[model samples]
Target: MAGNDVEAEKPAHSLFDNLQGLAFGVIMVSFGISLLKAQGLITGQAAGVAFLISYSGGIEFGLVFFVVNLPFYVLAALRIGWGFTLRSLACVASISVLTSLAPRLFSYAHVEPFSGAVVAGLCVGIGSIGLFRHGASGGGVGILAYYIQQRTGFRAGWLQLLLDAVIFTAAAFVLPGWGVLVSMVGALALNLLVAVNHRGDWYIAR
Candidate 1:
């Protein structure tokens, strides 16, 4: 029937709907990021680095996160398109605001460090997928890494690994040695979820 065909052709989400989805995704991510911060664990990218600085200097996580991501926008716009850049900006801003508001939201009385790391990983994993399906990226230095790979012949993964190494090294001073190791476990958890499910092959919303 013509009605059946018409219904099938409708977009799954309107533009406004997707924007809301993007905000929601970033909230979930910021919540997790804040939880991880409370535990003094690093996340292994721009966000992790922000957390590290926030811990050491007593600055707000939101400000550090927003500032660190500024440089990567140039790479994101050039390589990933303005839409992606804009969406990334939206994600960054939302997370920044949420990170600021998070402390007022609720303070954790007691959270086991390992448990907090695992929880942060799971939240970030799900949030990453939500952003992916909505056609946005959560901000990270990895954008610069991707741009470098495109221009030069280096792999983004290797570049990211190098950056992670530096982040963890700094984290060693901020957190206990075991906490640094658990941070790696959290990072692995986040990366594994993205690697396993974010292939375009697995998503067909377009």
Candidate 2:
């Protein structure tokens, strides 16, 4: 009991730790985004909105994603704190830049839709865990979800899942019917992973 308490009392992550963790999270998420782009698939949350706009408008995903997240910074700062808001901003910017560079860096020959969905889901989910553990996020809906979870005892993933349903529904009009279904699978996988693993009681870090 004493040892457990001591363990719980350990300090939050250092600057170096946060930098590496956030970088890892951003890279993983960017790779996942690239995979989704390769297959012409979409996921949920603000990223989904960016994908939809990018696909239809022929605008860049990074630009759209960054713009979509602008409003959320206010919410994040007011509710979550400046530290969290700043870290989230950095993570979001890094993802935007990396995802833009991803196409120039490498191209995929082919990726099966189902396989891509699962793999992309896993990558994003794991990466999100890293961000959450390090007191940051991919921004946009993530900031709202995390704030709600912290204030209301609601699980962030479940909240995100609910929001994802709305996003996927909108996706139906933008994408083919089958594509929307497959995207939902990816969203489900990602949200379920977060739901199970993102328990606040299990982690003491800020």
Candidate 3:
């Protein structure tokens, strides 16, 4: 009876709650991505790949980000659920649109690379937590990381850090040595923030 009462106190989120939460998450992430673009920096995970392609090909980051995430939806559906997959799809699409519109919305005159990286990391980390709490994600590596954590008791942030290391190394070929190092700082900040805060026990809302 006590367990039931405890569970009852933590009710699931309503549709409106989820919509707002997801919208907030998308806005935060898109802002972070815009910061990175402004600084000519790359992040980790699937977004990193998209950034690389956009930088090299002179293409739009939003289009590349959206396209790169397509394959991951299949994995998300198979491993998670259709509901989760759909929510994630919506999140990814919103980010794409927001990021595409970011340039016109605001422009940065000057932002130090290191400071910008740290701020961008914090933005993405907090935004991602919101998405996860609402039972959605940014798709791609986020889906994989969440699945691994749920299945193996591993930390999703740590797994992403490992994957980010690989992406950072590859970044050396595309970015200058100094740029790669600075990018690493951002990735570390983002992943560490997620690792420290994204605990299942800490948040009860589903």
Top candidate by lDDT: 3
Per residue, candidate 2 scores C-alpha lDDT tens digits across 1-206 of 99788777877888898888898999988988888887888999889999999988999999999999999999999988999999999999999999999989979887888888989988988888889889888959988988898899899899999999888888988999888888888888999999999887887665
List, residue by residue over 81-154, the lDDT tens digit for candidate 1. 89878888888888899888988897999988777888898787678667766867666765665456546746
RMSD of 1: 5.3
Q: What is the C-alpha lDDT of each candidate?
A: 0.77, 0.89, 0.89
Q: State the displacement of the C-alpha of residue 162, model 2, in Å, after optimal TM-score superposition.
A: 0.2
Candidate 3, residue 187: how far the Cα is off, in Å: 0.8
Pairs that collide in candidate 3 are none
1-206: candidate 3 lDDT, tens digit per residue: 99778878986988999999998889999999899988899999888999889988999999999999999989889988999899999999999999999999989999999999999988988888888888888859998998888788798899999999888888988899888888889888999999999898788876
Q: How good is model 3 by TM-score?
A: 0.95
Model 2 TM-score, all chains together: 0.94
Rank by TM-score, highest first: 3, 2, 1
- Write the number of the candidate with greater TM-score, choosing between 2 and 3: 3
What's the best-to-worst order under lDDT?
3, 2, 1
For each candidate, give its TM-score against the true structure. 0.82, 0.94, 0.95
What is the alpha-carbon lDDT of model 2 when measured against the actual structure?
Answer: 0.89
C-alpha lDDT of candidate 1 relative to the true structure: 0.77
